[model samples]
Target: MWSPWRIVGESLLSVAFGLLGAGLAALDHGGTVRIAAAGLAIAALSLLRRTLPASVLLVTAVGSVLFGGLAPLVLVAAWSAGRRIDGVGRAVGTFALAYVLNLGMAVVQALPHLSLPRLVFGVLWPLVAIIVPGLAGRYRSQHHTLTDTLREYEAQQQRERAMIAGQARARERQRIAQDMHDSLGHQLVLISVHAGALEVDRELTGRQREAVGVLREASVAAMHELREVVQVMRDSTEAPHEDRTTPGVAAAAAAAAEDTTALSRGVAGIEGLVGTSRSVGAAVKLRHSGEPCPLPPTADHAAYRIVQEGLTNAHKHAPGAPITVELRYEPDSLVVEVANGPATRTTDNGRGVVSGGQGLTGLGERTRLIGGLAHAGPTADGGFRLAGVLPYTSPEGGIPSPEPGNVTTTFVDPTNTFWQQTPGDSLDEGAPVMNGNGLKELAKAMSRKNGSGIAIGCGMAVLISLLLVIAALGVGGYFLLNKAEEARIEPKQYDTVKVGQPEAEIRKQLPKENSFVTDGLETDAPPVPKGAKCLSLTSTESSNNPDMEPVFRFCFKDGKLTEKKSFEVRN
Candidate 1:
């Protein structure tokens, strides 16, 4: 819908264009009524721009046939229709109609003298008038639509972030309640136990016994209330399956299951795993050194995961190779090492079995969380080795606890940045390394999306080339003009010479060969008559628009000039 102000603005624009068109028509000897009629028609049609833009454009296009001044108003209405209309089909239809009408009118008006070439040239104005405004309007519409979409997307993202933050706060509150129940509920239970023991004392007065009974009753009541509190906290923290009401629960459950399975199947079953591998036609051996120490749960988990991952690598990469698993317990550290010999033959159905290559990466992440280091690489021999070192006890003589506030995590996609060897890197390298190929690919993708950047670069190159050419031409022109001005000329001698003058006489009257002749033109003139010779002389002009030097020709017949004329070099 067009506002009143907008309608007025459109009217003003239409009238202004009408006046301009009338002025142009007046230049072509149009009458005052014709000019006034065109102006009034444009102003009237523009009033229907908002509600009936297509209809307005049609009428204005037709009107332009009678008053050629109304063409601008026709274009304006076409543009408005294209911008305001809902469907591209309708706008395109309107554009086509206007084009046909305008062309038909032109053809009708000039039917007496229309030719293929003239018709083509006449068709160009209407074509451009229809298409350019339509395209511009289409671009404006698309731009606005895109801007609206981006704004909506940004608003949606903000809402999503607020929702996620609220969810995190709720989860945190639940976690706090659960922790209180876990840590404080036991202390309350101990108080209830002690009060019960006092209540049952063998030696006591009636009042003392009564007091003890009261104390025990109160303690029991408190313990019951505490249990209720603990139960409520547990219920809140662990919502029932039907009441979970959250996304990612299934993924969380699956990840927990995987972790539990890996822990159970990793370090605890090392010997069994080795025996199982041997049973499956793999030559494997396990060895232990140093006294076995009671390792922390985290250390044991890390150690087990390292050996499990190493054996898995052997199975996948070095199939049929003899593998050795070594567990060494130092005074402070426990090390797990797995090595394999060169692959003897294909132990699986397929050759070069493709792997997602994340087994070692996950293992590394797990070990690092518990203050351990993991390494894997090719061995000096045609084989592979995997090694890990986990500290059984931290320097503080206790298991290391994860510090939540001070931890920063950077996730590396294994598919993109595959592990690569670094300078002096050993088989125990655990730090993530980015692949060079991935970075180059990312850069190329970014460049491809930047169309304006590429266009600007090409434009700059062309501009620089143009400037250089202009500078070179300027310097060369300056030197040529300076040399031409400095050269001397014998004007009187050449002016007095006759048309049949002798070649020797003309040569003597000419300036020094090194002076004026340098800028003069030299060319072979037309052949002289029988037994005659031809001569040419070149000289610069004395004018503001001096260009090429002029050449003077002379025909010498029997040692005398016959004909002479001057010609300027064209280019």
Candidate 2:
């Protein structure tokens, strides 16, 4: 069904074509009744060009032949037929029928004086009027189809790229959760074990034993909560790994052991961390400067991890060195620094502790999540230092504060995961199982093979059809001009004709009849001699004067010229 706007537009187009047909009818020297009737019929039938293109085309083609004023409507109908018809075979057959009708009518009209040139001109003129516009319509239809196909293909590619990016982010979130679970859970377990040992000491007072028992219970509760949080963070489709021997799991466990050696910790737990180190006979000291201020939980956790990493590195690399942990509360930020002097004892004291160097990498990643900076390197002295600067409020307005009575242990991963996926991993169900190279090749193939072939083929056909039309017009125009020149006679030649000369001799001297110029000669010319046939020809010398046209009439009776007269007809 057509929309109202579309119907209105097409109706307006039909009205304009009707007006054009009427004007062309006015140009013809036919009776007013015939001209008006042809114009009205052309206008009425144009309305059905889109809906009944084949029928309208046949009617208009016949009308153009009979009335000669509906040629434009015939061309319009031909174009509509090409566009609305479904298949190539049907369109070609319809156009062929219209063309044959036009050519056959022209042949019948010219049968009395038909020549080879007239027949050729008739055939070529109808080809130009009908075939050219029809081919143009088909080319335009093909162009629109190709454009729509390309648009749909581009939309599909965009959807695929977005889906791939989403899967990569889900994988990265799982990776972060795994790292946090392995690192935080191991430290909590160690704290529980140490506190349980302390609670059994006979030398401790009752109050001290109660404190140790509470610490042990707290560590156990924290570990359980951490496990539950990690499970929630992992991808729901993934199953827990029962085998701990996988390389990824083993690597994670090793990195976690080097994270913290003593207790479950955070910004508030730093003092207990230092005290535990001191109790183990390590010279660890804590220092503070500037005013203390509150910090967001994510930043506070990052600061504690920085100090814990420093102490852990010191134990592994500088066993007997004096270590210092400093906490400075700047006006807008919390600065943490941990430094240890050179080692005074061998690191290989029968405790084979292997460092995989992932602790500082994980610490840096964790600090950056809260919009902080972490650094670790050798100091000026023969020592090493680890430091981090955490804003009191994160630059990104801090992570949302945890709900009351709920712990906010989950950290936001700040890195872009779209570019982090391994190329060979499956994206998800029902997606194409291909790598990055395969995707790139597929895109290139679509671009290379989309629509170039169709465009070129249509363009060539249109070009060839236009060339044929131009050539036909050129040949037809040349012949018509030659015929017009041959049909013109000079004033001197007209005056030389004798009334008593033989009709054949006078014709040999005079030029052929120029019906194009002599058809409208004045009817008031002197009456021809009784029972004599007359021939009229235009004068070439008199054509220069626009106010009058000169025509010579010669009459023949009994096989000889009887009268010759020259008339100056009004223009």
The most accurate candidate by TM-score is 2
**Which whole-number lDDT from 0 to 100 does residue 535 have in model 2?**
85
| Alpha-carbon lDDT, every model | 0.58, 0.67
- List, residue by residue over 1-571, the lDDT tens digit for candidate 1: 7789977887787678767876867865679997776566666677667678788877777767766677777677777777887786877788888888888888897676454434654566665566566665666665566556555644544444333333333334443343343224333333433444454567777788788667656655664565566556545545334323222211111112222433454456688767756755678899999998877655676676676666666765666699999999888888899999998765223423333333565456445545677898898888999998888774333223323332111132223211122222211113222223333443355445543354465456446545655655566556555544544343444467797667788767653333223322433234445665555555544423465455555566766777776555532
| lDDT (10s digit) by residue, model 2, range 213-294 | 8887687677667756666765352422421112121122122222232223567888977876676557998999999998
The clash count for each model shown is: 5, 0
Residue pairs with backbone atoms closer than 3 Å in model 2 (clashes) = none
Question: By summed lDDT, which 10 consecutive residues of candidate 1 come out lowest?
Answer: 249-258
Please identify model 1 stretches exceeding 4 Å from their true place.
Answer: 1-8, 21-35, 203-571
Per-candidate TM-scores read: 0.42, 0.57
